[model samples]
Target: MNLILFTVVATIGYATAQSEQYTDRYDSLRIDDVLANKRLTAAYIKCMLEKGKCTAEGRELKSHITEALQNGCSKCTQKQLAGVKKVIKHLINKENAYWVELTDMYDPKKEYRHKYERELKSL
Candidate 1:
């Protein structure tokens, strides 16, 4: 009876570990999906920044990406990193352009808009 109980406990522990590993793998795959989709990546980051959901330091983004890569079933390659950078750059450019347009449409009397325009131009 003692041996049987030990075997059952060991089996359960192994299964639990396997389940957690699978979950991690799934999350990594999801991250890869996001990274692979340029439009999705741009939209996600832009929305996060615009909504103030993201920090200015970009630490969260970097950590999330690193974690995903670390837990990923397959390690990320240089090509993947380059692709992510391109997507981020594209999103930043788009956001800058949007700010510029908003600035152009703002009334000169609005000090806030004028300041925002200057900031966008600087970016």
Candidate 2:
């Protein structure tokens, strides 16, 4: 019984340590890399920018992109930038599921539909 209990406790401790390492890895990642990835970026933009008001973090992301565009970044590779651009295009484009999801969430607001359309175009 003691051995079984010890084994269970050790397993839990190992799992917690592994999860903490992943959390730390994620926390230290830069915003660009966070938003550049397909799954994270789309989910974040959908929830923060489309469904709800842009959070401070979201605004910071916009600022980051604008700054990068205005004065380029030596650290950012063209491939990384291109990937982000591609994902942004997917988000704002009329053909994607993201557009449909945002529109459905913004239902019953006539102006919101136009606003969503215009926002995508502006971006």
Candidate 3:
């Protein structure tokens, strides 16, 4: 799983801790809905890859990817972290192409991704 990609999804949540964490504006996002809808998922993937226009949520998620990847999503709330785990699992198990694309974009070194995957596997 790409840690940055996971973190990006994690950024989509409801509001809270804005002073020290990402807004939870997207906290209520139904990850299952997005995962079930290929088109929607592709849109997000495209947005992340700069291959298409970004929705507000997409933009918000993209904005924090670098920092989240570097800092282990320390700013994510519990709900967002849950979303991150779900998205990471989806991308790694279901949307591998996008995962690879995202990994290239945000973690070309694979340093963060490997670390995140190890963490996920341990869980």
- Per-candidate TM vs. native? 0.28, 0.31, 0.81
Summarize candidate 2's per-residue lDDT along 1-120 as a digit string, tens digits: 999999999999988765532112123336566546776666566554345455455554444443343343222445545544554455666336665554454343443455535644
- The true-structure Cα RMSD of candidate 3 reads 11.7
lDDT of 3 by residue, 2-119 (tens): 9988776677542234667888899888989999999999999999999999999899999998888899889998988888888887887778788889989999988898877666
**What is residue 35's positional error in candidate 3, in angstroms?**
0.8
lDDT, candidate 1, 45-123, per-residue tens: 5543353244332334444443433343233344444444454344335555534333333323444444433433344
> What overall lDDT goes with each candidate model?
0.45, 0.51, 0.86
Candidate 1, run of 10 with poorest lDDT: 20-29
Kindly report which residue pairs in candidate 3 clash with one another: 12-26, 13-24, 13-25, 13-26, 13-27, 14-24, 14-25, 14-27, 15-24
RMSD (CA, angstroms), candidate 2: 15.4
Q: After superposing candidate 3 on the true structure, give the runs of residues whose Cα lies further than 4 Å from its correct spot.
A: 1-18, 121-123
Deviation in angstroms for 84 in model 3?
A: 0.8
Ranking by lDDT: 3, 2, 1
- Flag clash pairs in model 2: none
